[model samples]
Target: MKRFFLQILLCLAALMVLGGCQSKSEIVKLPRPVGTLAVAGFTNPMFNWELLAGYLPHEGQPVNKRVIRELDQKLVQTLGKHGVTAYARPAITRQCQEIEVFENMGSKREAAFSYWISVGECMAADYLLVPQVLFWQPHRGMKKPNYNVQPASVVIDLYLIDVNNKRIVRRIHFDETQQPLSENMLEAGKFFERGGKWVSAMELAEEALDNGLMELGL
Candidate 1:
């Protein structure tokens, strides 16, 4: 009996060592950076489109600024693997002043541009990106019990503005929404926070960014 117990313990220890080595070998590898990049804060209301519908800015639900920050950081991580670099930050005072001189921007423009220009100056980034979470409902015709869109789709738009030319250089779009799961997997979807539905959207955006870079031949 003692000999049998010792053999079992040795086998279990060997299995544990093998498992650790296998896990380390399976780690995902990411690519390389072309240059430093940025994802600007949404000046537009997709982040708070509800404010434009009828609710006052003060009454509107506060958006988590962290969402934009996290996305920006994620972009950096993704781009790094593909040999691209991106960083989102605010502009400095002097740079903001210089940026103001370039635009005949109305009052709101000055406020918004000031923030971006300062960051752009500090980072000296080659490219700037602006993403919009356009509103959940645009028409304001339907009064639903909740803001949730059935099918839950919302347009995620991107506009690349030229700092020097003060014009839009490029754009991309993403449509994401809640989807129904298969009857067999229904229990899994209900239990998991995201299951796997959002994985595709994340991949889609990464591909879009990669496509954009390819278009630029970067």
Candidate 2:
């Protein structure tokens, strides 16, 4: 009876996964700048990236650096296509920098005149693109039901703030991360596989920026 109930729960979960996805996404816009502006180092066309992955900890997870770099590259390209003129910033490039610094170093409300000071006054970026990733969780595990090994499912939330404006310019939330059990799960003695969604958190950030920029009439 216990095994029977477990199977029922799993089936229900699978159905929920299939039904919860979105086929299309809406484009959002933000208030455009009053003047032509420079891009920040973070938004600059460079290869540095930051990935925030979250696990229950009770479930355990391996730190994936490769994934973070990939996410950064994707975001850089997306923002470039938009009119914001974005790229990687030096403030974001310090090796082994503290997460808290990235989170709080320069804010929109307080960083206007001083922002350039923080970045050495090169004065290229008139606007600052700030993004915070709140969550990144994976669904599924090393063990599969049908058997082929696969990546785990994941969900992420990313938001952006205009540092000079000192207010949130845009935010994006995505929850449809999913995948199916691999065929290898049906076989015995196979190694457990970790499954995950391929969505880049930075992509969410870029979407917010693009929509925000469009709204700005840029």
Q: What is the lDDT, from 0 to 100, of the residue 11 in candidate 2?
A: 50
Write one digit per residue (lDDT tens) for candidate 2, span 1-218. 99899767755555556534322234444556554343333221111123222222223343355555544554456556664453444235322122223333344323322433233223333444433223344333443333343343333334343445544444444443233433222311112112322223343344444444444434
TM-score: model 2 vs. ground truth: 0.41
Candidate 2 residue spans exceeding 4 A from truth: 1-26, 31-63, 83-125, 132-152, 179-218
Lowest lDDT 10-residue stretch of candidate 1: 49-58
User: Model 2, residue 160: displacement in angstroms?
Assistant: 2.8
Q: Model-by-model lDDT, in order?
A: 0.42, 0.38
RMSD (Cα, Å) of model 1: 14.4
Candidate of highest lDDT = 1
